[model samples]
Target: MAPPQASSIPGRLLKALQSINSSAPRLIASPTAVGSNANPGASRRASVAIIIRLRPEDSPPGGNAASPTSSAAASASTSPFAQALPLPGSPTVAAAAAATSEVSASDKAAYPPAQKDVKQQLERFFEQDWVKRPGTTAEILFIKRATRATDKWSGHVAYPGGRHEPDDEDSRYTAMRETWEEVGLDLAEDDYLSVGALDDREITTSLGKRLLMILSPHVFLYTSPETPVPELQESEVASAHWIPIDLLTAPAARYDSVSVDISTRLAPKNAFARAALKLLVGGMQFKCILLPNEPIATGALPSPQAVVPNAPLKLWGLTLGMTLDLLSSMSLPTDAAASKGSTKSGDLSTYPHAVAALPQDKGALFAPSMASIFPRFSYPDINALIWIFGFRYRRTLKQSPTDSARVNWAGMSIGSYYAAVRRALVVAVVLRALTALGGLGWLGWTLRKRLQSRRTARALAL
Candidate 1:
């Protein structure tokens, strides 16, 4: 089907953002006790900004326009946002440069407070003449990281962010500081407003077998009349693009799979052992979105030479996880559709309205996502089988779609969505190991028999 109505997205997004209730949190990366002394700003936590902005129509929408900000410098005053605090510091050339590991009291209060009535402020923001024009598609910013020899995320499609610096007052400050340092866009400025926070994600390694760090994805809404022109940092960023939310939710965006080298995921560090693992598991098939390089605003290299024009941009892994959380936050569920008759006419109305603007990956997830915390072996089809079994098992058990499964980022732990898949994984591994042992045992027995026969002069041979 064609992409969802673009103009209505802001309205839907506003509702989605306003509806977010932080009292009850979703299970992110891994669980941290609600009342525990665990700090979100711990050294392991890193932050990324999911910045959403309106590419305002060049003209005005006289009919739907809302009242304008009264300040003489409309874009200079305090902007409104989610109840959660936005980074509070006045940014200058020095602050952005130093990015010291410490945030002082003055540093924390550097920027103005964001308007807290998200519902009201956002409704007004979207109603502005420029934003209400026809075909006003919302866009999210994404950056390609500059390739570095030691950077694990080198040359990857990711949001702008970095780890919490010792000087950062909180996780939000780290995201703000990094965004400024990496892309030259300051979150503290009036040009943007905070959209609030997403669930904390626990980044992991070895197929979620080890906790690498905690990831906080902070969403922001751009309120400017003009498209954000980022001054790309040649050292940290390769190119910056404004991807329309419409393209992200389109059917074709998620139709393909990415081949990942997961052989090293759970293998020992020894070169021989890793190579042996690769031999056993040729490659892994995981989900990915074919992100277009359209509307590339700026880059380190000239547009043509900046990105391999021919090769498609692939988005997966931790970045994909954060993207999924953002999409989930934007959706509100609908009544499960059903048709009850011999005619068997399926009712399309039962399909989720919430998913209209969201990519629908066929999985046990309540919303579309990359599907697994672990990669699937394409040749052995171990991962694919897990998904298939999980789907069928859930159906057999008569589980509700609203209660679709969730995943843990920290390690191999999973929610109900992968319940059957987990069992299938154990069964498959055990059977494969047993088969290998049985073959080796039979070979050993045959070799012993031949050796014995040779030692004793066979009657016929004499």
Candidate 2:
């Protein structure tokens, strides 16, 4: 066969075989890099290298494959990488899928997420029991009418608050200021349990100016077996009550109502409280009560210019709304059976009775006396009365040009003082009116004088 002509074919094969055998047995062709000599199969595997690289585009794609000899250069020109990756059943694909699933499962279990906004944060805060609890103890305060021993609005539903002072720092201070001044309760620093603040309003006061009343209404509960006893201060408040928060918020219990001047209505706690009351009939959920509706400047009455007729007492306005809001916001379970089983009030008792059941450490539960916290009024009469001074000191005072001066100079403080002054002023005005009618005729003047004297006597007495 003349050397079989196979030598030509075998010559090239022999050279490749020599290269694989002589070298460290590279599994790759050309054998430019390190290879394994430890394994004899490495040489045997060298022949298969050509088969693995049969696709010229088997190399990675990129500028890094700029070299013409680089396998990636040829691979970059074609879609070889996609072809190399085995589908579904490949070990490499299976391992990667397993890893991804494991990671996803871990992440799903480890991290969730939440909501953060001012309104949302506040709403969340109000849902707490301490925030929601009907404050069993509360006080009401008002300034005494001029020359009167009693307050301008006696026996009225009111907030235990006063104007904000420099020390009060905020509206909470106003509430605390009035609380301290009106009642002798000494609430502690940590005693404050704030819910949410009500809207702000300009209050046209009977005492004076259009004061900016920034009311920070709060709900604080005091639980005890015994009723909460409030130390009364005759100067600031004649009385204090610890009524149920439920009652105050109850639509049925709301007794006072006028034409919807400048008030908002709070929805009734249930369908029952809402259907019964009429004056609280605005359909909204809040109402406004003016503290002393006299002129701001004159601090006197009978001036249309002084009355901001529709100006809501923003401070108390919001407070009232919040009080009702807090109560109605609670959602009792609709299923009677479910609610009965879950209900906790059955075993619960008042503060003293529940001492064993309640939390042990209730940091501070009382506020300071109003006299201790509130600044003394600047005027001599107001200041003297605030300090509980006797009439002797007031009797020594001099007269001024106005009738107010005469009343202030009189030995009177409290509700009786105002009554006396009001009677005297009304009598004088009526006497002038009678003179215009017929100059105080015997019958008219005698009857008027008797009535006037009786009213004056009543006003002067304590």
Candidate 3:
């Protein structure tokens, strides 16, 4: 009677255990954390950032700390698996050659100043290892711009970053500041963690003309359990999307070519513009990634006109290039041939039906005559000739030392004008040569006929 029943004690103990479990803090993995079943240092989540390094010559000093000579030496002392992996177009061979010729510290001190300078220059040239350029590693954020008549990039999907401001200390700050301003997501906040940066890419026109501005892509991680909802600044962003890292690998995501109208933007008379126009007018084919059901946080825009209700967002051009870089950095094979037997979950066939379908236009881009001539002859050859002679012609046309004073007839460079004239001259010369040959043949025929008639007359007189 004094002691409690055994069944009652067990129930009490179970209640106590439940209370303890409820009070305990749940352990959340860091964005960079690797799964227990995954290969060491391999990340299972798409939130992780991969820092891609460039060759020494191509990159600024201190970009990467590992020296090629030291790497080679370390590899020589270790097993085959420990040896540096051979990368496409890597400078390992050159590094090894330079390493072999390297002098000890004592030998360098003994050398004269002139000799030391020469050796240092030589070392600088050969010391850097050239590896196959690494792909981009960051899960970059892209923003769909609001449709505005004044904005050149209106309705285009682009990164959240913008031009550097005087208030920004550097490009990293510009990216972060822009992120906060446009998306209402403060990258500097506690929930977000800064990752490394990708190499700076030069911004260019759609036709491949270089621009003055350069872009630096930075990666970040969101540590919170819940996905942060982006508050879009309607003036800039129409909608913001968090594209899955694996979305690009989907089968249905592939679009061989999609037509984009860019004629209005390009100079119609420019040779480069002409070539691009020819390819794009009928719809230029491009490697594209489609995101149909990706999470999109809509902002202040008209209902029907805002976002494609349920259509897939097509990513192409520079955006597509950046996506490829991200995949390449992950060491994931991207080629159609290599991706076929892959064991990734990115196969769109396994996902729901695509809400938006890309137009199927896989037919030949060029006419039969144009297609046949393109391989053996094309605009590129003509452009090359213009480039070489155009400058000289421009110099000749200069009336004064100043470029403005120089005559720019027809709103084009003297090179272009001369190129057109040269082509006309060639055609004219060909026609004249043909006419002269025809006249000579007629005269010869007339003489031969006269001789035959005289021979017949002589025979009749006999």
- Please, what is the TM-score per model? 0.68, 0.27, 0.42
Ranking by TM-score: 1, 3, 2
Index of the highest-TM-score prediction: 1
Cα lDDT of candidate 3 equals 0.39
Residue-by-residue lDDT tens digits, candidate 2, 91-177: 011221132232223112211121123223233333334323333122222222222324433333345555433333233333443
Candidate 2 Cα errors over 4 Å, as ranges: 1-155, 189-212, 223-226, 249-319, 331-462
Q: How far out, in Å, is residue 395 in model 3?
A: 33
Question: Where is model 3 more than 4 Å wrong at Cα?
Answer: 1-141, 250-252, 268-283, 293-295, 302-308, 332-462
Residue-by-residue lDDT tens digits, candidate 1, 1-462: 122333266655665555442211223322242456654344566778889887766523221222221112212132222123544332112322122333333333322233355445666776676666666867788888877766778888899998876566655677877787677677887777765555456665644444667676777778876655666666677767777665555333443456776556556477886786565556655556667764354444534444566466777767776776565555544311111221321211111112222223332222343333234554445655565666543343343222324222222223333454456556666666788999999999999999898878676577
Q: To one decimal, what is the Cα RMSD in angstroms of model 1 from the true structure?
A: 10.3
Q: State the lDDT of candidate 3 residue by residue for 324-395, as single tens digits.
A: 434433331123334444444232212121223322232211001100100101234433443354454344
* Clashes, model 2: 32
TM match of model 2 to true structure: 0.27
Collision count for each candidate, in order:
14, 32, 6
